[model samples]
Target: MDIRKATIHDIAEKLKITASTVSRALNDNPRISDATKKKVQKVAKQLNYQPNHIASALRSGKSRLIGVVVPTANRNFFSSVIRGIEEIANSLDYKVIISQSYDDYDKEVQTVEALLNARVDGIIASVGKTTENVDHFKKILRKGIPLVLFDRVTNELDVSQVVIDDYYGGFQATEHLINEGCRRIVHFSNSQNINIYKERKRGYEDALIKHGIPVDPNLIVFSKLQLEDGRESMQQILDSKIPFDAVFSSSDYSIMGAMQVLKEKGFKLPEDVKLVGFGDEPFTSFTEPTLTSVNQKSIPMGNFTAETFFEILNHKDQSNNIPRKTILKPELIIRDSSINKEKPKDQTNLEVIEK
Candidate 1:
């Protein structure tokens, strides 16, 4: 009636092999041949072998775990990034723990503490939208735990970050609209405190100015850039009787909402108003008039973020040599929503620009 968990030693005894050999095989060590590793693993599984992570942590002084914090996992962009991170993490025999902040600053702070309490080797995070005070992230640095930020990054903390060139993205989106004969374009943006949004807004303005179009403060609507926010902003623009022929939103969700309102108002897309959005969310392509958007390169962002974390963790002495900021180029996916001129229905639509 007694039951106990099987150990590496038990597997070794069952296979008539040394415990060290069994351990190396279990770890998929290069020294262990594939045939030996397969046999050892099969036997270990048959014996219901379970690794003692606590003992391993105690001996190695590492949990062999990584923490990832994101605003939410519902979005394709965030989930894709997490997948990319797992690809690298799994290869290194490390586990990833994901925490959701739901865009709350207090919750983000709590998650950092919780991850630290769990003794994670390092943390990879995308700053929450409402997180203006980054003291919680700074605390991780004080403890010497590697922290890498991606996507929603902050300049307040001096840490490694992976992000797309948002300024270039905004510029490209705005310039594309202008080239399509869109003047008096309305813009949907979020808080200016976040560097990404700020840079995007800057790019939008500069692009307009470069085309001899004066930047109109009245045309820029600032909000949380959610779907509801997009609806409200579009309504506001309509109510103000602002003459506009295009809309460029920083978020795909918001632009989708704006598109909904525009349709409800009996406006014909492209013919009446050209539209462009950011993030290049998958849903963009399936909409009535497929949306043109900025692709953030989520997969590469996640890979680079994890790589940066390992760099900080494994090369603490060479920290100064590591680049503080890594920027990925953004791609513009041209689609029906942003095109005013007539074209073939089967035109391919991907444009990669240099930084």
Candidate 2:
């Protein structure tokens, strides 16, 4: 019963059966009766039988598997990002196991834990929208599993990260509104759990401060990052007599909702109310008035995240822990939404100095 010497032959001899029968039962072959399969598996496990996975994988030098985690696979931004990841992953002869966090902190922790149990060669992840903990990646780091983060990331973890210039993206978005004659610009802010949204909010606030425009405390509204939140918030904005002229939304989905309602309420885009959104999502441009938003090169971000993960996996012998990071700039894609006669480079740089 010693684990070291335990073998299929030993198992078969103990059960007075053929080695082929024992092997098939252990492998859970349908040809093996359920009772025999259960009995053989029990005895093998009881004897502490361990499959030679290392020997098998090392012989071929191929596990051919990777893991990718995102906040939500259904969201447009993440979907585009994953498509980019898959393109690289497939080219590198790797299969990716994908999971969604549903924006729940606890669920995200569990999903990562499960992926680790699967022993994926590498991991590429965008943290859940509400996840604040970095402890989940501790096991992966400790085990020397190659890890690369994209989009939402951990400031404390110090791992490889690929992200866009979120702060600057926000600044440009807000600045566009001001230039288009929006006197009262409203910002839809997100929580600090994710650095992307938090940085964006900072940029939005900075634009107001630089413009010498007194920051209206009520103008910044914190909402869940969703289309419904955008619609509800916009409805509230319409309900109020705040005399708002434009909106700078953190997400394209929310921007879409706000625009839809504004149009319904007899508001004119650009002429009366200018709108600009972030992420430059596909749907943004397809709307009646193409959305003016920041393009983060989502396709490249995904491919880069996967490529970085593989690099870490292959270069494991070179470094125990690699502090790899990639930063991508966001470009302001001006469309019909915000109508400005002349657009200057760094147009938002010089905010009107307050008296």
Candidate 3:
């Protein structure tokens, strides 16, 4: 004997009820009684009935799915943010589809297009490092899809965004180094075209000026802020014969590379030269001389981004409800890399030597 697949019609026939009644019960429609829903659910389990979500989505005009795009999924920051997004999305019975841009502009465009093709209810993204043209994002808006950006955002697009106070993080990092007796500080920066990097650079310069330290153009280096770039920047500083006592990198990976070079050169951390980095990566606390860095509140930022998406979705039909931008504060985590072993009574008067 051959067995037939179970369907709503079969369950309804078994219970001597209408197929529409079984469908509503299975969908947990409030109009259906609790006893009816339970009976229908029990029959569905016994018959191994599976609801076709795709068909239901098409009928309801709501996929109940969200798309998320990030620069790189491997990074702790992005991963943490993704987790927060999932936490909120799952609570609302929504599923998430994630994609990585790999910091490539073309790849970002392709990813966004793919998500749009998937007919997701909304999209959350962090702009890629090389993303300059945002026409692709605008296309999503034109199609009536809700969009939200976090971290690496662009002001040109009038969309909801969540970001940390990168400027303050930079200022605090530099000021910590100054207080630790580091003068002639070297700064490893990412592309200035990115807003976060630009703000960090500004903060670093302002902190120096506030402390009456001359800003040296030679000490500032711009790169993609990769580990290799960090190594290369350090090498350039060493070869230039520029006397430097500290280094502040916009990325933890880059600063890790700089630390590798400093260690190989037999320089004692926070003694020969102090150091600090952004992102507060997990490894920062595990190194021989633990690193000092900035914590960008990545998980919270992610939660806020997802929540913003929901808000947009709720008000999508209301033209008067304007999108809002959310800004989070960053924290400076001091460690062996930037702390003075012997605390000075008054660090303010420490003399700094510059070349």
Candidate 4:
């Protein structure tokens, strides 16, 4: 009762063909005839033969594997993005290996290093919040491995990237609140060090200025934009006695935290404190009152990131040429959270803007 794994040699022996012919047929090599290919494939399937990817990669110098790095998969945005990446990679006969950084800088560096050590053909990544120095990413470029950044990216590295127009999203979110008659709108920001956060903050300020409202420095609260950070920021705003009628949070989690505080404190949403959040997390719609948020186009961003990696791989000879920076537009989804009944302005319509 011995069991054995099937190999190309087994299929060749069973079909009375040379192993080389079987190999070429299985790989769909142009040298093999269609009849031989069909016969080899059928025999291989009958024998439960699986191609040795490692050996093939070693011979061809292509692992056909792509590595992806994200902040965390627990969030809806990152998970959805990974799904989109896999869909494209699978179609191209490439495998994907995913890693998480948990928003930690050192962890991100370690993950990238591990992927490189595994001999992945390419990499798609979203930098962590604390990632300021990109020397490790430079190492990937030095090794001539195709790398593409998505979502959280930086201009310090000269590489292809896929990112949503954070500035436009912020502007739209802030302007929507302002249109709802919110004069003193507070902003809950995560970190100004990150490019996305900085762009969003700039958009918020610009929108206020455009609407003839003086940008109040006191209304801006900076933190990690976590749940506790949101609660603490809200508490500080209450303690400071700063007059604020609306809030535009940079992340959905932070906004939920702030909303919790508002609810406990008996502040009526939209009536007392109109609020808008970024990232349009799934929970936004299911909350006590639906949240108004900006859709980051996560799935499309991921798909484009994978596509860009393949484009680079295909043009490896010219990879050192000018890099491509793809910017996608975001949509603002209006809901019960940010609308004022007295000043309603087309909540049913979805608004999209590009930068």
> How much does candidate 4 score in TM-score?
0.87
TM-score quality measure for candidate 2: 0.78
Pairs that collide in candidate 3 are none
Candidate 4 per-residue lDDT, tens place, 12-99, comes to 8889989999989987899999999999988877887878766787788899999999999999899989998998999999999999
Clashing pairs in 4: none
lDDT of each model, Cα atoms only? 0.89, 0.80, 0.88, 0.88
Q: Estimate each model's TM-score.
A: 0.86, 0.78, 0.88, 0.87
RMSD of each: 3.7, 9.0, 5.6, 3.1
Q: Which pairs of residues collide in candidate 2? A: none
Q: After superposition, how far is residue 153 of candidate 1 from its true place, in Å?
A: 1.2
Q: lDDT by residue for model 1 over 73-164, one digit each (tens)?
A: 99999999999899889989889999999999999999999998878998999999898899999999888788899988987888888888
- Window of ten residues with lowest summed lDDT in model 2: 346-355
Candidate 2 vs candidate 4: the TM-score winner is 4
Clashes of 1: 0
Model 3 Cα lDDT, one tens digit per residue, 172-191 = 88988887777799999988
The local lDDT score (0 to 100) that residue 221 gets in candidate 2 is 78
Please identify model 2 stretches exceeding 4 Å from their true place.
Answer: 1-62, 318-320, 340-355
